[model samples]
Target: MATNVAMDKKPARQTVPNAIFSLDVVKEKERYDLWRESIACIFEVDGDRALRRTSDFKAHVDANMFGPIMLARTWTQQQDWKRSPSIMARDGMDHYMIQLFEHGQMQWEDGTGLRELPKGGLIVFDLAQAVKTRTNDFCNLSLIIPRTMMDGALKPQFDQHLRVLAKGEPMVKLLRDHMLSLKSVSDRMSVRQAIEVAPATVGLAAACLNAAVDRENPHQGAGIALAQLTVIRRFIEANLSEPALSVDWIARHAGASRTKLYKLFDAFGGVGTYIRDRRLRRALLALVDETAQYRPIYDIALASGYTSDAAFSRAFRAKYGIAPRDIRGNQARLVDIGLPTDDKVDRRYERWLHHLSV
Candidate 1:
């Protein structure tokens, strides 16, 4: 019972508050130790590293947290970070960090493998996993979230098979822009408002990294391909009325091969069928709007990317089992024709996102 009681006490964690630090304030010899303690509180990283040059230790820090997720901006000289098994056991946190390297070179090795951190790179690091990072002078921005939150949003295999997200990857660019956008206004945001925005960031990050992992797994044959397909479907939805919504266009923009693209949407009967079905759904919504009743079906069909009303009507009936005009001017009423829907994905992302709100 005493041992159980001892285990019940929570270990100390860094405070979620506004903070700042500067190496200029400390004596040269003492600055290295001060940096270690300051950074531990800043990142909840209570591991070990030896400064390569203590005589002229130089770093500046500014940090904030929306909630459990934190953003830290750091400038440092070279250091070799070594997180040992014992250090991890004593750290008292379980989380993952997606760090953006703005200006620096970091070569990191862990259970996965070693890779030179890309310029303007965003990479994920798991606190529970041992990692070694050898870096030259560098500046970085990092987003830290609990392990469970990321696991809910991304694939379960993410931590087990970690990889560096190279610069210019679509998902990497999206996440980089997202974090930078939030930072531009974070200083004015209240803790509660910032908290609300945290999960959406996590969702976007998960979607981005999921794309990276999926892109690497074409050889493995369908390792979380649904997440990648979700990305393509979203791209398609946004461009439904586009003249470039053809398979070749999607394959090119989405960086998926024609064969790979076809395999991903096989359950939807085929890519063309899926695109045609979704276009009709959008047209049905537009047609049912009372404000849009003045528009002719022929005009609606053309805007819906159909060349002719006859082609649109035939596709619409085959999908919704009813003529498009039947639902006209219905004013937001959803007429259920019970068309086959795709679960091509899961709702786990919602739960992951909700975790940030709390």
Candidate 2:
């Protein structure tokens, strides 16, 4: 977007120095050294052998902090970039890089088999691990997730096994498109807006990593199940008026079994209970609206999937300790439904956010 061309690096914000940066690789007599510095500054890694080949290098970076995680994107061309054992020892290591490559002929090794990404692909490699890379032209959007922030994300076996995400994989493609969109609009964002998007960045990256790893292992990824639960929740909300919306339907929609669906929604109680509670919750909102008074209770009941008014009324009273008609008379507003309605779900999310801050 708005790039500061060939200028010295300066802090975008006083409080957080790394909000954004732009550098145009100025070609001077010692331009090779400057290129090396540019690569190091842009990627926060070491050993830029590409500067030896050509001095034509320029890059821009937009970095935002979400808790301790940093979301960043760089558009630049450099040849070979390596993070060797010496660099690791010198820099000290406690972070991992998850990169979505847009263009590059990159052959990178992390003491495992080499992953050569020429086109579209993503890579997740830890800094504590060994790294050596040879590349022709490389450009990417990446995130730096501190090891502590990755607590529930990376298992030991996964850290050792899954590193590169192939171009055509579903999760990789989705994350790539997502980051591209984020980058396109990032220049217009404020520090507050950038901070607000950090959790989304973490969640999306975590989901993609888990999906890719589970796909490789073929043991039915729990990550996929967790991600799919979010989709199913939206589906349930959209179809609450339908009479056939049930636990079986939700399981089928999620591609999860009835048992798995039950477990996924255990925090909200059983699947059926959750669906009923949500429907009743919506019905409560409708019941309190003056605009909806023209519609009879039986109509609202049927719309909420009840066969008759009696069943809906009984369920409503059992849940709320009041008849449906009484809500309007008693001036029941949104507080009558209670805040959030699920402490178990809220606490679970609170703990996840806390881990990110750590």
lDDT of each: 0.64, 0.59
Per-residue lDDT tens digits for candidate 2, residues 258-321, read 8877776765556787678777867776786679877788878877888878889999998888
Give per-residue lDDT, candidate 1, residue 272: 83
| Residue 147 lDDT, candidate 1, scale 0-100 | 57
Off by over 4 Å in 2: 1-27, 38-67, 75-78, 109-114, 160-162, 215-358
Write out the backbone clash pairs for model 2: none
Question: Can you give the lDDT of residue 321 in candidate 2?
Answer: 81
Lowest summed lDDT window (length 10), candidate 2: 344-353
